[model samples]
Target: MTKDSSPTQLTHFDQQGQAHMVDVAAKQDTHRTAIACGVIRMKAETLAIITEGTAKKGDVLGIARIAAIMAAKRTSDLIPLCHPLALTRVHVDFSITTETNTIQCQAQVETVGKTGVEMEALTAVQVGLLTIYDMCKAVDRGMVMSDIRVLEKHGGKSGDWVSLIDQQDHN
Candidate 1:
């Protein structure tokens, strides 16, 4: 297989075009932070059960919050190419939107390491939503998760980036 030597080439591929983890050994250690967000929509009754803490599973959001933080720390284990990072902080937040019968999850992950924590943040958001689904599935199996994305990332050689959708919302 031929390799793309272009600067824009995918980092996970080597000169022989084989998939491998990027070598960050030469990279400088910087304080990196990433934020990710997603939303899960469910039936109004299910949302009510979650908000009112009436679910049979017990304290849905509280459990999911813990699950998200754990997911962030374990992200490298789940994704093959990801580096195991020593995270300095992981913060997860959930907001209920009664108008849309949805719950939004956001995660902020930080690490003083060579690579950014984008994957950790994204993983945390996804796992948080999954935990919510698992706890409430009996009442709302049709719950849908959507809009999982990295909202912003700071640090690294390439510098900072913010999703266009996120920028528009703030504007």
Candidate 2:
């Protein structure tokens, strides 16, 4: 309930009650990269249908990949207070684990900027997962979105981080 208690909330607003972008000008520009991931769990049969191009939607993985890339490019437009960044590269890949009947969506975003690209990486996951859900919903209505999280972030003064999930076997 207090500003000091919530660090995230404290840095998000300004004195006049108007939302403002955090001033990162003083911070040194560094090569930054963020890796984020999420899982879409569903029936094994449904996963097979998608992987085999049997779904009515057509090329589910391709569409999701494009959506993720586009989402990363448009992060600043979608999220207020985020700086527009020129990302050097954005890669979104899906690991279809047949054994688990889950699609692991991973988005890696890189940039040379004052601020980190964690939000961009996260936005890519959200939009990519949504696209997968949209394309496959006709076949599996019970699909669940879970395990959405940042797997790692590197560069900047914070140095490097590897998410807990990555430390554990994704199995």
Candidate 3:
């Protein structure tokens, strides 16, 4: 699709309006990468427990990282219309901000395939935050997850795209 194409165009729908996987067979295989990020905020005390490794559950960040990677690999299985692609790499990282009592999860998913890895990266972030909440819910049930989004994406017919929030940071 070109940049001039209708913004409302839904690639997953056919002329009959039936949901179907977009035909990517004609698309070239390229090195596609997608970076997604999100943050989960909690009480100061809960953050302290996590940072100090005093939570009843073992390492919170470690478990969440593993869950994020697993979620990336199984993205197609979870999302009905996603095409299954062999991911070349899945990297999940977490950063804790004591001042805000928040943990940020970033996932970068890459693949050489007809389509992009945006969905996989996004799935990883969501699952990672969910895992963190699961591990720490006992201590802080009010933990809030926000700012979930694809930071950037590269390759594919549409070419590279970066979220305006990230672009502004570079400038």
After superposition, the stretches of candidate 3 with alpha carbons farther than 4 Å from their true spots are: 1-7, 169-171
Q: Candidate 1's C-alpha lDDT?
A: 0.94
Ranked candidates, highest TM-score first: 1, 3, 2
lDDT of 2 by residue, 1-171 (tens): 232435356676677677778878778989999999999999998899888998787899999999999999999999998899999999999999999899999999999989899999999998999999999888888999988899999998778999876788775
Error of 2 at 19 (Å): 3.1
TM-score for every candidate vs. truth? 0.95, 0.88, 0.94
Model 1 regions more than 4 Å off = 1-7
**Local accuracy of candidate 3 as per-residue lDDT tens digits, 1-171:** 333457489887877888988788778999999999999999999999989999899999999999999999999999999999899999999999998999999999999999999999999999999999999999899999999999999998789999998788899
**Ranked by lDDT, top first:** 1, 3, 2
Writing each residue's lDDT as its tens digit, candidate 1 over 1-171 gives 123245566878776888998878878999999999999999999999999889999999999999999999999999999999999999999999999999999999999999999999999999999999999999999999999999999997778998998789889
